[model samples]
Target: MGIELITLLIVVALLGLMAFGVPLGITTLTVSLVTAILCFGERAGFFIVAANVSEVLHKYELIAVPFFVFMANVLERSGIAKSLFDSMAIAGGRFRGSVGVQTCIVAVLLAAMSGIMGGEIVMLGLIALPQMLRLGYDKKLSIGIICAAGALATLIPPSVVLIVYGLAAQVSITKLFAASAVPGLLLASLYITYILVRVRLRPGMAPIYDIPETGYPFFKRLKFLKGIILPAVLTFTVLGVIYSGIATVTEAAAIGAVGALVVAGVRKEACSSP
Candidate 1:
């Protein structure tokens, strides 16, 4: 068959399989295997498929993705997100839309640690969303902040998406991380600026976050920094090792996973103490 006709048939088959509700991954794999067997004999086709799968499995950078994912899960279960939220909220003080602004800040920190959007969004939704609502922030504003901030994971350093792209394109993951860092923070800054502007234009959209701790002076609020120190240390440890050339992305991800467990252990110990 002509290559053009083959391509057309593949597209039609994919669409038909998807329409029938076959999972995308399974459908694509099945179609590719069948196509290979038709084009080459069965033995060669199976060997080709196995070789391709083995090649992907052997990419060192690919290991980072799962390590980062595991780190995210560990941090999530350890209650670090709640701590970061509480610290940022109190440290930011009583400005209008302070909670939303702090949510953005917390999201950035979470993205730095996790490098996964879904987990960060879930953490914010579980922790920040209700707090904003309780403080009488507008629902749309609250939801928008969570979503926009959560997506920063995809652009931040140690991003799983970037790792996969680097492996596929044969580029340096470190360079990709470096290129994305500024853009990610820029987006975060835009989010913060929008929240502040929106609240200024319509004060009722975000009631000032009021609590006794917020009434404290800036110097007094330094103690709240304790809540964020572990996360900052973990992020710095992982990214520092990568950027400083002390480790590759996979090694840094392993470090991050271990660091997460240590942080969780420390938190657990502190809670149980006294």
Candidate 2:
């Protein structure tokens, strides 16, 4: 009991040092060594460290964390977001503030598939932000859209934060993913509503683009609907199985990732023809 009290004190001291600007690794090491010595006497302290290392090494499930990270990185480099964004913009150009809305929309979908913030920001910033700006949208609004979407890229599903928390708490990771969906959409809705309302109130903030002065054909509209719908169905299928007890989180993520690839391939094939 005395040793436990001493350990608690050492941890608090380390956190205080961090609050005062000490580096985390050094602070943690210094505090832990002192705690171990005080708790078990100096001689027994060495054995405790070897046990900690052994525990870390024994966590095989942890291998999934880095693989998921790498999968996200790879998906970004594969141009999947570009496909999704362009598909969304086929009709997104005609309506006022639609481009900004589409930007948020695509960012949410992309973040669902990939949780890499840097890639989300840079990709959308370069591709979507400039398009919004050149179309006569206000500078501040354009920058806000990009920055906000980027900042939020990691908070939603497939998030590294939730995964870490789930692992620590021994909570079900699939539930964590499901739990994030409601809030993710809520935040995204807030952003879209804000942008649309602001654009409406000011009128000068978001510019509307006319891809064609005339309305597009109904058949073309049907085709565009197919483009977005197919992928949505596929992703839903994968997630449904995972969250509904038909499959595990690992199994579901694998299925979802592959489903995305198949959908992307279909879209690319459809577009490649004359």
Candidate 3:
């Protein structure tokens, strides 16, 4: 068959498989394998497929993905996200849409620490979503904020997406992370600014997050900042090692995983102590 016809057939096959509800990964793998077998003999096709898979598997930077993912899970289950949310809320003080703004900040911090979108979104949904709702914020606003802010994980430093891309494109992961940092923060700043402006104009879209702690003097609330310490340390450790040239991206990722476990252990001990 002509190459054009073969390409069209492969596209059609992919869509058809997806329409039938096959997972994207499986569908792509199946189509590629079938195409290879048809283009080359069975033995040659299998060899090509194995070689490609093995090549990807052997990439050193690819190792970062699981380590980052594990760190995300550890932080998720450790109750650190909840603490970060609470601390940021109290630290933000009384203001219209304060919870929403705090949620955005927490999302950025979480993104910095984890670099995984699903985990960041899940953490926000579980911890921040209900709080925003209970505070009388608009339903659509709350959901939108969580989703938009959580997606920063894809752009922020130490992002697994960038790691994989760097490996595939043969680019520098460090430079990619540095290049993305400003854009990610700028997006976050925009989210916060929008929240502040929206609530200021609408007045009813987001209620002020009022509580006893919020009533405290601003400086006195500084103690609540303790909640962010571990996340900050972990972020510093991972990014610091990478940017300082002390370790490669994969090694930094391994450090992050270990730091996550240590943070979890410390939090568990603290909770169990009293």
How well does model 3 score by local distance difference test? 0.93
Q: Which stretches of candidate 1 lie over 4 Å from their true place?
A: 1-53
TM-score of 2: 0.71
Pairs that collide, model 3 = none
TM-score preference between candidates 1 and 2, better one: 1
Q: List the candidates ranked by lDDT, beginning with the highest.
A: 1, 3, 2
Give one digit per residue, the lDDT tens place, for model 3 in 85-184.
9999998899999999899889889988989988899999999999999989999999999999999999998898899888878899999999999999
Global CA lDDT computed for model 2? 0.72
lDDT string, candidate 1, 1-274, tens digits: 9999999999999999999999988998998899899889799998898898898789977989899999999999989889889999998998999999999999999999999988999999999999999989899999999999999999998899899888878899999999999999999999999999999999999998889999999999989979899999999999999999999999999999999999999998987899
Residue 178 error for model 3, in Å? Answer: 1.0
* TM-score of model number 1: 0.85
Judge candidate 1 at residue 72 and give its lDDT: 98
Clashing pairs in 1: none
Report residue 171 deviation for candidate 3 (angstroms): 0.6
| Per-residue lDDT of model 2, residues 114-226, tens digit only | 55576678889877987887889999889999989776666776665666667667788788888888888888999999988998999887667677521576556445544
